[model samples]
Target: MSDFASAAMLRVLVQGMRELGLDPGDAPPGDGEARVQLGLKQGLVQRAVLQGGLACLPLLGRGLRRLAHEPTHQALVAAHSASDLLARWQRLERYVHSRHRCVVEHCDDTQACVRHVTVTGQGAPTAAEDFVVAGVLAALLESIGLRRVSLSFGEQGLFPASDPQGLAQAAAAGASALWQFHWQGRPARGSAPVPGPAAWAQGADPAWAEPVRRAYLHLAADLARPWGLPVLAGAMGLSTRSLQRQLAAQGLSYSRLLAEARCRVAAWRLLYTGDPVAEVGFLSGFSDQPHFTRELQKRVGMPPAAYRQAFAARPVPGR
Candidate 1:
């Protein structure tokens, strides 16, 4: 039976294909020797790239490479325990899969760990798709300084045992894969503390805090659209009054949550993206440039430009 990839994974694959200048429509078949060209031609291979989103894996790896240097990304990886790091990683995975169907599982011993991911409701994956998945996994492990990483497809033994070319060969055989990663020496003491649910809730009750936060994250990027209390309440399947009462129980209000969400997104963009302050403001749902600047200053204690400049000037560690 063929395995399938989730839409979230497919989206990332599509983005990567666009970055690599590959045409998803021209991908080859996924069987026999023809599978060797799976990355290049159209068929199940192409469908996997277009529908499963494996093409975005490479680009996501590249993005992670860059983000590893960003303070926020760095802090996330600086978790004290393997479980903590995995939890944080799971949160990221959930965010990416918000609009799709996928299952991700992580298992960690003290020195070694495995990540098992599968996309439901799809046929078996193509060689090209598996290759991308392996590459993305390798990239993520490398970004976090994991060493001696190995991958195995079911009971087929270590895949891509020696080099990258082997990945295609192994995937040609059609089997599910598991990633194995090892740590060197003592695990480095995390430079940042692992954040609790409270960190995300900002003093709200943990029960409904994550749902409220997730709602904001899902909507934050579309600043030009209307996302008032009624809209958000509807999305959560609650009446406006019910939602309000729930937030009140947690000592939060819809407006405050919205502002906090905008501020969080604005701060990140200000630090990482090269977008102009005004553009960032608009993208973060502010009424105008001045309002964006004012709110940012009020929340972050610095104007957007200054915040960006300050972070930019700080020498990136391990650069």
Candidate 2:
């Protein structure tokens, strides 16, 4: 089975697009079309699907309505690649910019809001220490200068966490947009977009791990905190070193998992909350502010204060 955690991020985007005024007519070419259009480079379309998924969340489908196009009635062989998805998003961003009027303004400190965007492309197989898909999406939004965004593992509405075929088929058929407008243009500010805070997967599943699919479900609300393997191992009745061996057998490591968790937590805290820089660090389990600053800058392309300043300065939409 694939990463269900990652799959849900796309649901957030589909939801976000509808919130932005997207209609069925504005839907872009599917993943298959995107790949064939790009000649199957690598992960482009997949990354774009993931990135657009998140960037479109806060706006709901309104952004999608803005992007809708006449369905390509011509059928072409379907191919899947993450890079092709990213290219499709690049096309979408260009379309959004060209057709819409967007401005970046400042907001009052207390009223400011941080939003995390999550998106995933189609897949049924898991990859190695690569569950940090949300981070990749956040980076995509930042590239377009929407630098004030956070990320979360979305609820894909699929069942049987191990291998939810229903959700996967829905995602493929574009039924993933069911919850796009559920947020109703309401502002969450520092609160998480997901009803309960959700934690993202650090990496791939271990070879010998139990069949439980919702391993990261409890972490949904705790996105602000780093859920380290040591803690998880403690919960799973294994020593940290032993856990390391288990993940190692699957071609992963505790450090890799920790890094993914840390990166995602830092991204959410930095983007969605006005929490003080030091507190953001502490909340994300970074004992040192300097370390947090360095890593956040590396991940977000700027210092926390500057990032917050840029976003907080922007007036809340319609304020």
Clashes in each model (backbone N, CA, C under 3 Å)?
Answer: 17, 58
- What C-alpha root-mean-square deviation, in Å, does candidate 1 show against the real structure? 13.4
What would the per-residue lDDT of candidate 1 be over residues 1-319, giving only the tens digit for each residue? 2222222233334444545555555432221110122223224345545543443333333334433443334434554344444544444333223221213355464333343444444434445544555555544444455555444544433322433334445555554344454444323554332222113324322466665655555445333334678877886787989878777876778888778767876776665555445445544656645777899899879998788878753432221
lDDT of candidate 1 at residue 242, scale 0 to 100: 84
TM-scores for all predictions: 0.40, 0.29
Root-mean-square deviation per candidate? 13.4, 21.5
lDDT of 2 by residue, 1-319 (tens): 1111211223333334344454323333232111122112123324433544423322331222222221110000000112222333333322212211111121232111122122332332122111222233333332222323443224442111112344345445643322210111222223213221243343324443541222333232333333566666765666877767766765556565455555665565455544445444534544445777788788779887777667653432210
Highest TM-score: give the candidate number: 1
User: What's the lDDT for residue 275 in model 1?
Assistant: 43
Candidate 2: Cα lDDT at 164:
39
